[model samples]
Target: MIPLRQLPRLLRIAGVLARHRVDELLPASRRPRSLAWLRALMPAPGADLLVLPRGERLALALTALGPIFVKFGQILSTRRDLLPADVADALTQLQDRVAPFPAAQARAAIERAFGATIEARYASFDDAPLASASIAQVHAATLADGREVVVKVLRPDIHARIDADVALLRALAGVVERTHPSADKIRPQAIVDEIETTLVNELDLQREGANASLLRRNFAGSDDLYVPEVVWSHTSAGVLTLERVRGIPVDDLAALDAAGIDRVALAEKGVRLFYTQVFRDNFFHADAHAGNIWVDATRPADPRFIALDFGIMGSLPERDQYWLAENFLALFNQDYARIAELHVRAGWMPADARLDELEAAVRTVCEPYFTRPLSEISLAEVVVKLFEVARRHDLTLQPQLILLQKTLLNIEGVGRLLHPRIDIWATAKPVLERIWRRRSGPRAVLRTLRRRVPEWLAAAPDMPQLVHGWLSRANAGEMELRVASDDLKEIERRLRHGQRVAIWLSAGVSLAVATACVALLAPAGAPPGARWVAWLLGAAAVGAFALAARRS
Candidate 1:
């Protein structure tokens, strides 16, 4: 049930829908009073009822709503093939800039979160925001040592607002699942779950700080990429302080051109960085849009990427990682059958799926791209189509991998914008090959043995004692045997219960028979004829129990 206090918000949402002439967006056929009543208050003018492209209108409305909605739009934009072309294009323009908060409020919130004055921690602090995003805004500041840094502050009342929105989204998802036929395909609840995970992660600035620190460690001593340094002393869940980065924004092509930077090399490095993160380190930044990327034009010929946001990231399970590496290598080698086999082996498709059929499905999606020039190839489009085909072939792709695929598409987008002719496959293939060779070759086996030899040596002293203990247990008659069965588990339970009852009843019958036999053979003994009869009766009872035992 919607809370009483939250009904007003629900009414407001309905009002927004009514004003936008989108009452059909809400399923009011079921709840006329709650949903339709609001729509009835102010009917959409006839002029407003005209149909535009569903995707574009949807994207525009989401972006206009605010930061949270804009972020949602950006996420949906990555799923181009799932959406109509016009809507995806509109959502692609949903950048992360928003109006900044006042300096007083920002400083006060930071002081309250830290329980101290900002002056004590910083030599100088600016109230003006250096940049404002949907979730948080960053302000320029200086530490006590006169080192420049940026302070990221979460928007006030964001948690409460998000909590309310999530509640509504969950309720809406439940409603859609019940009413809509395509709910199972779209997985509305799962999308909301992903959003909840990503948004909650964004709320914790300290976690983002740690992510930055790890990425910095991964790329240490490298020239292709750089991550800002997190100032541990000043970072918190609500606020983060990082070494301020000075670079031309990756999206600012004109500025980079002015700096004499090689856009082609910059684009190639982006692909290389992505592969290194995925295949080499098995860690990657999931959110890498133009706004989150910057170019260090300090060295024009050797430009390095500066990654900002780290809240949303992705990594694969080890098995998936292996299959993905093999898949990429196979694609590079034009081995579609190998790709099909990997998908089946990885349980990405049904176990009974025919290899040839799957190979054909893959070829149908990939063949068009193969004939295209590198400059004309949209890697994102290829991935989206692959997903479409995979769904048809019964592939329930992992959610984590979906995020990675979207991130890769974003990186590819940035790359294509920088240099249209860069061969992403060429850059990525060598990295995957090196990783596969290191993991699956004879040298890897030798390395593994070398690492394990010390453990083997350590166990040598205890080997004889362990053998002796096993022998001693065997001789003492204290051994236990266990049998495992999966096929007859139910039958086994029933059989064991039956045996317990049969054993008790048999013992009772045997005792009675023995007593009768003793009485018959007493001093007041039975005559010869009767004694034979008693023996016969006793034997019959014993034989009956033996039959029961055999059946059991």
Candidate 2:
């Protein structure tokens, strides 16, 4: 239940929705009867609004609500499969272009963050904003050393506003989870949590600066991408200062032509850079919308991408990274069986799901796309189809990967916009294959072993005691095993044999360590006592190994 403190805001939201006639979007059966009285009490929308499309009205209402709601709309826009085409299209137009707060307020925020006057910090600071967004506004400024930079200042009291709205959203999500029939599929609470995490990360400018710095370091000397340097001395949590950069917007094709830029090469580079960031570097700029991406025209023949807005960088967990890379390769190869197996092995699908059925379902959905020209196939659509198939097979989608999915869509959109004939599969396959080869090769195994051996050796001494305790407990009848079937009984038998092998191996390793210690620490002029101790340890090591070999 929503608290009394949130009731007013709840009513405000209901009123906004009603005014926009969003209730009409829902069937009468699904609409709550309780909201009827409230709708009657609220003021009606203007006639101008009544003439607008329902989707546009909804978008406008969300914009009227605040940045948090607008952000929610932005996230929803990416999931075209889940929403009506018109609604998703309308939401795609929802950009982060809100009116800027007063210059005095921005100045006050900067002063409070740094505890210094604006004049003391910069040589000249512009009062008018260069660009204004929902959470922050960017102002052009010059450093004391005459370097130009852009100063981004967070909106005043944004945290309190975000906190209050987030609490309201959580309450609403709980209500929907309890009441909505499709709550499991919608996962409203998880979506709210994702929005909250994204907002919280974006709220910290210092963290964003670090992200920009790291991305810059990763692409240092690279011809494909350029990241602006962060000005640490002038940056803080509430304010960020980055080196100023200017380039043609990536979506501006006419400008590219005017500048004699190679659009085809530029588009191919975007695809390659995206795969490099995700698979090779494992760190990618999640928000790669046109505004944040610009093309450097100075090198018209060899263009580079200038990235902006470091607030929403993304990285996958190691397991997800590997599985996703393999999944892409499987899709590229049209290996539906491998795709099905991967989904199950990655724990995305239920273990009991029949692989043959899953493979058939995937082939049905994806095989048609292959009939089309390679350039005509949309990678985003293929991913969406995979997700649809996953839903049918009881797929457990990871909340953490939503960012990567969104990034993929953005990259594809940009790539197609730059060069409609670009084959994303062809461009990305080589990058993934190269990464897979590097990661799974013999040298990689050797590197991993070198890094892990010390840790294993340090823990070797404890294994003998642990294994002995387990065996003693089993022999004492303190451990019980109940098998429900012949398969389980066979598994139990194998487990017992494995335990015995573990015990022998542990004893062997422990004795070996003791022998090594005795030999390494013994006196050079072998005193009889020290020599005997060394001999005993060596003998014990040999005996333990012999026992282990016999047990196996």
Best by TM-score: 2
Q: Tens-digit lDDT track for model 2 on 270-299?
A: 999888998888999988888899999899
Clashes of 2: 0
TM-score (all chains, Cα) for each model: 0.78, 0.86
- 404-498, model 1: which lDDT tens digit per residue? 77788789989988987778877777777887787779887756655664464466456446645754664564553334776577677676678
Look at candidate 1 and give me any clashing residue pairs.
55-87, 56-87
lDDT against the true structure, each candidate: 0.77, 0.85
> CA shift at 512, candidate 2, in angstroms?
15
Q: What is the lDDT of residue 550 in candidate 1?
A: 46
Pairs in steric clash, model 2 = none
Worst 10-residue lDDT window for candidate 1 reads 517-526
Query: 208 in model 2: Cα distance from truth in Å?
Result: 0.9
